[model samples]
Each structure stands twice: as structure tokens, then as C-alpha cells.
Target: MELSKIIPVSKPVCRSSYPDNPHSLCRRFDPPLLVCFSCKGQHLENRRYYYYCATCDLEFHRGCHLFPPEIKHPFHLLHPLTLIFLDPDFQSSRIPIDWPDSSSESDDYDSYEENPGSYEGHIVKCNYCRKYLQPEEFGMAYYHCSTCNFSLHRICAYIRPPLAIENLKCHDHTLTLFPRRVPLPCDACGFSLDTPFFDHVYSCLLCNYMVHRTCIYLPRVIKITRHPHCLSYTSSIVPSCELACGVCRKTVDVNYGSYSCTKGCRYALHSKCATNKKVWDGKDLEGVPEEEEEILEPFLWIDEETIQHFSHDHHHLKLRQDGGSHENKFCEACTLPMTVSDRFYSCIKCEFVLHETCASLPRRKHHPVHKHPLTLFHPSSSNPHKVERKYYRDGFFTCDGCTRNCCGFIYRCSEQDCEFQLDVRCASLPDPSIHDCHPPDHPLFFNFTSGSVMTHHLHFFIQPHHFQLLLHHLHLLPHHLHLL
Candidate 1:
């Protein structure tokens, strides 16, 4: 038989029941511990109160013991949260919505609540702080709302103020917190809520505009990975303009929002495109002055007609502007036939012929075909980038830069083992270029190349009938423009 109850150390604990320990005793701590059992809060060292202690290791405060079985919180107002100390039901029900076992409650849950105080290798994200909660926080006390499956740190719940967010840049209305996971698209960034199942967002019921709570804090100006300049945020990307993103090459809606260079540069990007983890470095430089870049001239004058070529060794090549039509004349660099009125470089005596631009090709070049720089490779040399493979005896080297299988001069990567080969057309593209007859006041910049035509506003169009060109049934690839 059990002996009589022990003497009252302090006052009697309130009438409350716990899941793990039901009939608990009232006890006063000799030396107040640093933490309480229910709230995991610091117990004042001197002040004494009624506390229920199942074991000497864990104790709860009188107020903590009297926590309403279920209470409503200001952060999430849709559902009342039950005081769940530790529930095996934390593993959300995963049955399909269409199946008989399925329900509205979320089953895909975090593993931290499964085995209390034993989540070793896990990524537990906190919805309130927008940070990954450490393993110790899950081991300690916390609150969980089963309907939304949203959990908060025990300490965070106390200090977190009522939900109230607003930003003039994103929206004018006062935003209310929406804690439930819904299939809704955000209006500020114009993207669907791309977070996990349990995350929350801010909504403006008046305008029907919803935005991720995190996106409200995005910087007005930022430097992305692909560009060196800081791009300023634009609230209205007019839909009729048809702007393309510099990173993903996707079309940006004119009526949506985006970022663009402030110095009248043509570099434009979508909000999501610029803030991507792969593209953005997470720096806000709004209103910071960034220098405008100018495209530099590619070459200096060598002479009037005759010039020394970088690809050839012995004699100077003569520039022929009026070399009329021929039976089978072709440029050695581009491997394309030369038409009448085409300007090109011709050897004095030998069968060497190159387009005038190709003669001035740089010995080394940087092209988008490879991340590393490429050097012009000549025949009869060992290249480090290529594995020992047999080549056609017909003097033909495959050019990956042009995606062509032909014989001609090419640029190749030698050190990085980067398997990139380029013909002169893809290799010698200049940073700044000028026209022979109608050059623009500012040099044209080399941005990127694609099958799509550039959206730049053309200053003027030149007449195509100025030259008496030769015609042939040459069925080659069409639309290889130096895409601005």
C-alpha cells in the first residue's frame, strides 16, 4: 500500500491533465531551473509558484498548466489551435484527396515531431522566422496547429505580434496573413506561391492581390549573377513592348513587373529571373550609382587595302572590294561562297581567300560556346582538349561552334578540355561594330545570339538594291543574324 501524500512544499497545482502524466503533484523548486517543461521558458530563481512535476527533471508553471486546451492565435485566425504538447498525430495524413481515407488535413509533415528530442538529420523550417529551426528547438517545447500543420517555436509564439504587413511598392492595401496552403498566385512578383505546403502568405482582400510574405521584402535594386550593373525594379512592365529576359531568354509580360538597367541599357529581366538562387547574390543596392559601360572598338587601322593577317604567316593579304562573281569562289573562314560586290581578303598569288572581317580575327577569343576562352588552333598540332581520335584525311575539322562538319580554320579550347570548336563567324564577333556605309552614332553591342530577331528599334533601314549582286540556287541556312 502507498503511504500518505508528502507535505505541501508550495501551493497545490491547478487541476489539469497531461497526456504523458495525468495525476501530477504540486512541488516548489529548491533551485529554480533555467527552463520550464510546457513553455521551455526561464523560471525566476527566487519567485516560487504551484508546479506539476511528473519527474524531477521536468516541471511546468501554474500559468503554463492552465493553458486553454485549445486557443485561437492572432497570426492564424482561420482555425483555433489546440495545445498539443507532443502528439503522434503530427505525421500528417498522406492519403490522396480523392481516396476514401483522404481528408482536408495535411499528411505531408516534418519528421521533427515524430520522435520527440531525436531529429538528427532533418531540415525543419520555421514559418514565423522564415529560418530553418535548429534541431534543439524541435527537441524543446513548441506549438502545432494540426489543420494547417503549421508549427511555431514556443518562445516565438509569445513575442510574435498580430499579423499586419503593408508595402507601397507591392500593394497599397493593408495585408492580412493567410496561413493555409492554397493554390493562389501572387500579384507582386506574378508567380504562384512556390513555397512548400506549410508556408503562409499575405493577402489583400480589397484588390484581390496576394503576395508571398517574403517577396514584400525584396530589394528595389539588385545586381544579378549574369550582369555587372545594378538593375532597378520596375513596377509596371508594359505588355505591348514584348521584352525578353536576359537570363532565361523567356518573354516578360509588359503589364507585369520586372527589373531593367537604369542607364538606358537593353538588359531586362523578370523579377523571379533576377532573384533566382542561381542568378542573384542577395545584395540590395537600390539608388546606388553604377557606371555605364561603353562598347570598345575591336581593332585599329592597319593600312588602306593591304594588311597583315593574324591566321596567315608569309605574305600580306590584299583586300578586294569589287571581286565580281566567280564559278566556285568561297571564303576560307566562313566556308560560304563569296558573291559579287562582296569585300574579302585575297592572297597575291596563292588560292587563299577570306572575308575582310575574318582576316582581322583575334588570335584568342571569348565566345558563349564555352565558359573558358578559346585560342585559334592550326593544323599539325597537339590539342589537349580533344581525346586521341582519328580525323578525316580530307583536312576537315568538325566545328561545334557552328555545329558544322567541314574543313576550315577553327578556334579550339586547349587547357580546360572544353570541347568547343568555332568557325570564324562564331569566333571573331567584335564587342563594338560599325557599318561600312551607315554606321550608328553609338557602336552596336554584342549581347547574345538566338534564332529570334532582336527587339531593338532600328534607326534606319538601308536599301538592298544598292549592289548588283550575283544570284545562285544556294539552299543554305537562313536567318543567322548577329542577334543584338
Candidate 2:
């Protein structure tokens, strides 16, 4: 047994059983009607013994009473784990510890710190289970390593396997546990094994296959919403030039493991990127058959030049290709002024109009910035946000990708509770594409920036006279707006 993984707070508090409560004092009860204060379970029994507090009228499972106050876990050898309490919403309890600023000395461990709260209003997840820990309702206790900012579920700390294993699904040969920590890359995920919380390493003697314990059971076949074809895990890809990961737009090292399209296609993705929680839905499609998807048209045709758009079903729109001057007219979808030579659709009854390209945009699209499908939301005229009359007459929505205020039809994330939205311009940007104004050899990429400034690279390509106009249009200052 690994003694470092389990360290008790103090010697187990031995107390006498309450003779007044016969059922509570017993080791087992049918159906377990009594509630345990620690686990909050209707059943009052577990592998650990039960203890009762006659003074407080509280009963607890023995495991809760003996929970270790500190322990050295193999996953995080840098620091010892401390027992911490969190509410249902994952908010740290009123209890205080050395945090954000750890150098300050405190007279008492349980006393509130003089400094403001260190960690609160932050989402904490168990590193092993990847699930939110809620100790408030269930009376569960979790382990935390503040120095390393690592967390582990209380039960996960007890999950210890034998030194060796055999009969694996992903590999054919028997695998042995490597005892010592090695600074090498895992052959399964192509990520360095020296990473934190990945100390458990397994290896095969028949071949040079070595992998971190966490990556030993990678799915053989998986499907993601971003790709059309199913992807299969491969030990390595054939050496290639200029190969980039489909999701991150970064170069893929061909010598390590990765996921590649089973169908004859050039598409590939890094194992780490493909299995990201934001990208993969955590479904293994090894034996599952692919389902056919039905294509839906964005609009219905009324005549040769007229159609009814889903967004504006109140009236039919007539297409116009002739160069006509509609001085103040703007496309409702893109919020850009209608050019004299542009082909667009105009409402037969009202002033609603859309650029030809914007009118044909799909109702749902896959964008490189987001993993989930985004649904198109028509502009709300009642909204107060708006651009200048030159760009749009009224109404605007903030683009989540570029953080720009835009007056146009926006695509919002389809996932519930996710408020991510972006304008048509930011949504249509290609990941790796060439710009006519910039050098052709250096392809431009869509980089999301949090700072309110554009990068210096723009000054080299943009004309002097138009630079001010570009800043003015984006509502950015001289030092603001970083774009790629």
C-alpha cells in the first residue's frame, strides 16, 4: 500500500456508541432508514464503521471522521493534499487557508485570514474524475493541493491498481508498470509524460509502446461534430510536409501518435486536441454505425427571382442584379451598405434587404473558434447598440470571437446556457488563409485576443490614409485592437 497517499488528520476519535438509539448503534440495518451526517445518504452503513455524537445528535460514517488532513499523492508529488470543503456550487467554504498570497503568516489554521479571500467564485474540478465536487449537499469531502492548484476526488485517492496488467483493448501484449518517473513522451497521446498528474507510466516489452496510465485506454474510433468523417487512432502518420492539425491549425509531429481520417483524406488532428472536452462529446463510436444527416435549405423559393427567407418570413424578397443606387439601404444580415454594382435581395413590401452572399448563408455552420454548432439569430431592431449611419442604421450585437460591436445577423452557440455569439464577418474568417495586402508566404490566422489593441503587423500592410479610418470603424484607440 502507498502510505504517502493516505495520511490521517489525527488518531481516529474513539467514542462509545449511544445505547439509547439501538438501530443507529448496530453495524447493519435493512434498507438503512437512518441518515448519515457525513455522506448524507439514507443508508447509514459503508465499508467504514459508524460513529454517533450523542450531544450534537449527529451520526457519521467512520470514513468521514478518519479523512486525512494531509497526504502526498503520486499524481502531485510537489505538494501534500489537504482536506477542503466546498459548497454545492463549488464555492470554497468559509474556511480560510494560505492562498493567492502564501507568504503571510497566520496564527491559526482555522482562523479567517486578514487578506481578502484567496479562492472563491472559481469553478473547481477533480483532476482525476473531471467532475465538479459538491460537498455541501452530500457531505462529501475532497482533497486539494493549494501549492500546485491540483484537486482530486476523495474516493479517487483510493484507486490503486496492481504493479502489472495484461489483456488490453488498445494493445496486444502484456504491459508492465514502470516504477520511476521518466521525462519522456507518451507514445499513445504524443504528449510529454513529464507533465504533472501523469506519473503512472505503463510499457510493453514486445514493442517500444509506452504510455501514461491516463492515456492507456484511448478510444480506437471516435467522431466529433467538427469533422465529417470518423477518425481512427494511429500510432503515427506517414512523414509529410506542411501538415497541420485540423482543430488548432498547428503543425503535427508525424513521428508521434495522432488521430487521422479513416477515409482517404488529408485531414488530421492531434490526439490531445481531438479529445478536448470542448471538442469531443465523450462518445466512443467504435462499433456504432454512422447516421445519415438530412440537408435543410435555408430558404424557400416563391418564383424565379423571389424567395422567402426563414429569418424574415413575413414578406417575400425579390432578387435584384442591376446597379441601382439605394443610398441609405443596408443588408440586414451583414449590416453593410449596399453597393451600386452588388447583387442583393430586396423585400417586395418593406425595406428589408440582404447581400447575395449573406442571403445564402446556412442556418447553422461549424466555425473554427467554437466546437459546438452555432445557430443564426436575426438582428433585433429594438436593441440600442448600433454603429454609425455609414455602416448600419440601427442595432448591433457584440461578437464573441473578435470582441467587436457589429450591427448584423449573429450566430449564437446552440448549446443551452452558452451565450457565445459572433457576427457574420468574424464567423466567416478562415483559419489559415492568404490576404492580398499581406505577403503571400505568411498566411494569416484568426487569433482571438483579450487585449483591446490590434497587433503591430497591421501597420506594415495597411495604407497610411486608411489606418485612421480602420481604427475609427473598429472604435479602437491608437494602441488598441490586436488582430492577425
Number of the top TM-score candidate? 2
1-484 in candidate 2: lDDT tens per residue? Answer: 2222344333333222333532222222233335545434443222223445555465544444444356666656678887765543222222112111111222232333332223356467777555665433113466888877888766566555556767467678877776445677888777876666635778886798788776777777887756778898887898866577776667888887788888858988898888877677677789987776565576899998999988788899999876265647877886777667778888889988887778888888776556677788685632333222233334655676655677678877777656677777666644455444456666544332221212233523332123333433444322111121
- CA error at residue 32 for candidate 2, angstroms: 36
Per-residue alpha-carbon lDDT of candidate 1 for residues 82-117, written as tens digits (9 for 90 to 100) = 544432332221111111111123323222222243
Clashes of each: 6, 8
After superposition, candidate 1 runs with Cα above 4 Å error: 1-55, 58-177, 194-200, 203-209, 217-231, 238-255, 260-269, 274-285, 288-292, 306-354, 359-484
Error of 1 at 90 (Å): 14
TM-scores for candidates 1 onward, in order:
0.41, 0.60
Estimate the lDDT of model 2. Answer: 0.60
> What TM value does model 1 have?
0.41
RMSD of 2: 12.3
Query: In lDDT terms, which candidate is top?
Result: 2
lDDT of each: 0.52, 0.60
